[model samples]
Target: MNKATYQQQFTTEDSPGWLAIDDQLDQIYGDTEPRHYPPLCGLHYAAGGSDPIDGASIYDSNHQEFHRHIVSYGLSELYYDEEKAGGEFSKWGFELTFRLLPFQDDQHDPIWAIQIMNNLARYVFTSGKWFEENHFVPANGPIRLDTETEITGFVFALDPELGKIQTPHGEVSFLQMVGITNTEVEKLKQNPTTDAVKELIDHLKKDNPLLITDLNRK
Candidate 1:
């Protein structure tokens, strides 16, 4: 939608951006109530009591085999503010997403995904740095601390299913975080270019089209 149109339409809505995001998800998820996880604590180093990422919603995936899809809130301007209306890009122009196979026992909730997103948001809120398409991050250790897993890092890609959407606040891309092995991290570091990341993602898509992060994949 055009800036003028969005501005006019969202003027009276309390949280137009938030609603827009929910509406987009509804298209994919229908009426399924996702497992939502709010910020664990009120205090954060950058935003203090207000976290940069307000919450995370995890949905049972339809496009992948027994995987969960996680989406974030607050990476963008989720609430309406007259000053931010119809901007070129929403706060950061994107929210983080992750698709993962069951990381633990089947009954175990995916709260870890929420924690990871908050940590990533904390990095951005504190460092003034932001991630973009094809960026990669090495997790120093297992992506899950104290876990015996080969998945030691991540690579960002536009979510295959959610892709991107235009909101009253601006454009928001669902940037997906895909787990990678330490070996893959080393390969990405060898070139450390968007192309390298893209190539790796492309190769991954051949078998895993949805790019679901499997902690068991070596």
Candidate 2:
């Protein structure tokens, strides 16, 4: 099981902010590869070691793929907000990176990448039901990525042989015993009522009206 690495770069177009970034869709550089560029490029990641996604096209449109990056919505701190630069400026927000480890069939995406994308989904679903089964609920309580500038720009390298990931900055030991899977979620399901599971479900179901609308299921 391999994990994918993603990097987010937040910028503010005013005062020459993000002078080093662009809004292109085909240019980026980091220790690894991003499956696609920004603006809801048809796919995104999610919590747990799940599969890559075909992002809904209602809200974001991969408008500026270059300036778009990854981050944990639950952890993202920055967001764009300005009146003069129109609504497309990349200012007033911090960049984020998500690392979805690589696997045999699917590619890697950054962690928290799903959360960020889901927020986008909420805005898209505002007008109607999603997939005809799940209704849209505006995303809220999302994590911000602004305060993590110091560590958000760093990278982690994989050491398959040593069963760990090493970076010029630091390292994380990969426990081969579990073999990398989303079992964490499955395990959580066993107890149907744990606080941790409820929190996780709440976060995952933020945009899912079908889940939240129910008062008995939870």
Candidate 3:
């Protein structure tokens, strides 16, 4: 379903939440510690039986001794970038971080979901993003690693009324992502059922035929 076909969800229930996602991805995000980590989103991987095993259980299974999921990625010290803005999104940029669920549930891998989202972004926007992984500080714009005491991360919403993007790190506002302005957000909030939004719905619907941004998904 496209944006128009998608029902707006005000409740915190997971059903509608999943409906808004290109793929219902919030579950694999792993709800623990500091609230946010890396990859704001994850793929649903690792399964036992036909039933799904929880993420925490998988974390404990392998780390049995460390007793902490902090270093699961194997980085001694995590570096924080001082820049927070990018390309045209500088003034409105935000950072999202998350954790890996580390367990599998017979569904699909979070990496695969990442691949899907990347492809979806390309298919929908015709712009290549969601894959331009940046290392070190961004060449231009704001880049700042937010420091908080015992604070992991949070899913940010530029315009809460529009939609969201879940990352392994945190959630970002879907509308604000592609250079959204106050005027646009206000319009979206006031008239979600407008024709322009309907057009978005149409676009999403037409994207189901599988447009390949990368052919290496094996």
Provide the lDDT at 72 for model 3: 14
**Local distance difference test, each candidate:** 0.85, 0.26, 0.24
The list of candidate 2 runs beyond 4 A from truth reads 1-36, 40-97, 106-120, 123-182, 190-218
Candidate order, lDDT descending: 1, 2, 3
Deviation from truth (RMSD, Å), model 3: 19.8
- The weakest ten consecutive residues by lDDT in model 3 span 70-79
Error of 2 at 122 (Å): 3.4
Q: Per-residue lDDT for 1-218 in model 2, tens only?
A: 11111112223433222222221112333233434333343333333322223221111113222122332121111223232222222221222222222222223333344544454334333533221111121122212243211111111111112222222112223111111113333444354343544354445435531121111121
TM-score of each: 0.91, 0.24, 0.21
In candidate 3, residue 109 scores what lDDT? 30
What's model 2's overall lDDT? 0.26
Give, for candidate 2, the lowest lDDT window spanning 10 residues. 172-181
How much does each candidate deviate from the true structure in C-alpha RMSD?
2.3, 18.1, 19.8
Native-to-model Cα distance after best TM-score fit, residue 154 in candidate 1, in Å? 0.5
The TM-score leader among the candidates is 1
Q: Sort every candidate by TM-score, greatest first.
A: 1, 2, 3
Query: What digit string (tens of lDDT, one per residue) describes model 3 on residues 1-218?
Result: 22222223222233332232223223332343222123333332222221110111112212212211111110100112122211223211222222233322214333332332233333323432322211111112111122111211111122222234442222433321111223333444565444644443334226311111111111
